[model samples]
Target: MAWELATSCTNQRVVGSSQIQNEAMQIGRKEIKLNTTSRAYVDPDRINELKTISSESFDLSKLIRLCEELNICFAGECYLSMVMLTRAILDHVPPIFGSSSFQQVANNYSGAKSFKEAMQNLENSSRKISDYYLHSQIRKSESLPNVTQIDFSNNVDFLLSEVIRLLKK
Candidate 1:
């Protein structure tokens, strides 16, 4: 794949190949390079599956939109946005599981043990993290969250899979 480098205010150049001698190329006083790879935290297929479900009882528009935004935030390295979106989803999906809250879903839903575990993790862990970020005041010494700190991808995928299963039934 050809990578484009923005050298200056007006001039741009394309590198012919992926192999470059240096990660960044110096053009005059500016260093220019391409960020080639992109990341997806949420599986696109899972979002597609949610879209394919045509249910009259449940309006999934908001849920699907949250999931889509979660994917975008993670890919763009917006860890706080991603965490908040995840918390929103956990708050939004309870009624679909015949419960009024995620905690109740985690405890009472007749899902597989693994599904229940995933729900509990999201309910306990992600919610706490989200709350910390959401409610904590600015302090003298504050540490920002990184990708590893906010990664709940597998748990979310498991939860989405269960949602797809339940909705299709």
Candidate 2:
């Protein structure tokens, strides 16, 4: 399918297997990770179930406990745990979405692309979700805060620019 081909052509792609191996050597990497054996990746249904729970009913304390366990047991791939936590935030506590800390977590998982661009896209997605939230609200007088202004202009861009600048050194 077109989607499959497009995804396969993402920036993460290496031109050839030998090139990948060469790059790995230069980067001092030992392995080329095709798929992670993380339990979260294997269990799609559990992820979906956790995503559907209401914020009022959702147990943040329990999720934090799980995060701690994952951090201990799967410390090398802490990014997966972050993805899980971000998913939960998208489903339940959407307002706390674009905090500087969240942007830092995103930076941790970002690939070869500009992290600022990634964060900007995330904010755009959040805006769409917030529009939906506004429509669903019973009180018309209450307005959804425009977090995008606080996001792309200041925090994420600054953090990502600093990260990139450091990498150049």
Candidate 3:
């Protein structure tokens, strides 16, 4: 038996919907998103997926921002930022559920007060995942190479879907 036969490939998510739109401009920590009206929203790009649907049941803006950041991370070719945004979104949503269980997280979204504060709390939380590259500003010869764009993109896709599923619940 060969190593290829013994080792199995596992791709949990399909990398289709998490791609950047054909028309988007990347700026520093921001993206200029072109809307149908020929307008752009600056910073924390809000490209709403459910633009037609009213979000009276649950907040949709944050989820959309995740999508936008994903677009920015890819369009801008910054894997580190993409990873950060994805992980941050996951970390932030726990409070919405009132618990940190995104594998089907605990969310009491109805009890939620402020979106901004919730995000801040999670950002400051201990479970927040940090990128090895960004944290290791002082690169060491022994340190491993930075995460590849493909890996980051796939992770974003998986995490995005999981968060969306949790929200829809």
* TM, every model: 0.76, 0.22, 0.44
Q: Total backbone clashes of model 1?
A: 0
- Model 1: per-residue Cα lDDT over 1-169, one tens digit each: 1122212211323221111222222322222121222245566677778888988889887877777666445434567888998999988888889899999998888978988887898899999999999999999998888877787888988888888988984
Model 2: which residue pairs collide?
A: none
Model 1 RMSD in Å is: 9.5
Ranking by TM-score: 1, 3, 2
Candidate 1 error regions (>4 Å): 1-38
lDDT of 3 at 89: 62
Over 4 Å off, model 2? 1-113, 138-169
lDDT of 2 at 130: 43
Candidate 2 C-alpha lDDT tens digits along 17-114:
23322333454433322233222211233323333445542344444334233222122233333333333433433223323454454444444466
For model 1 the local lDDT of residue 53 reads 94
Q: Pick the candidate with the highest TM-score.
A: 1
Which is the better candidate, 1 or 2, if ranked by lDDT? 1
Alpha carbon lDDT of each predicted model = 0.69, 0.35, 0.40
**Candidate that scores best on lDDT:** 1
The lowest-lDDT stretch of 10 consecutive residues in candidate 1 is 1-10
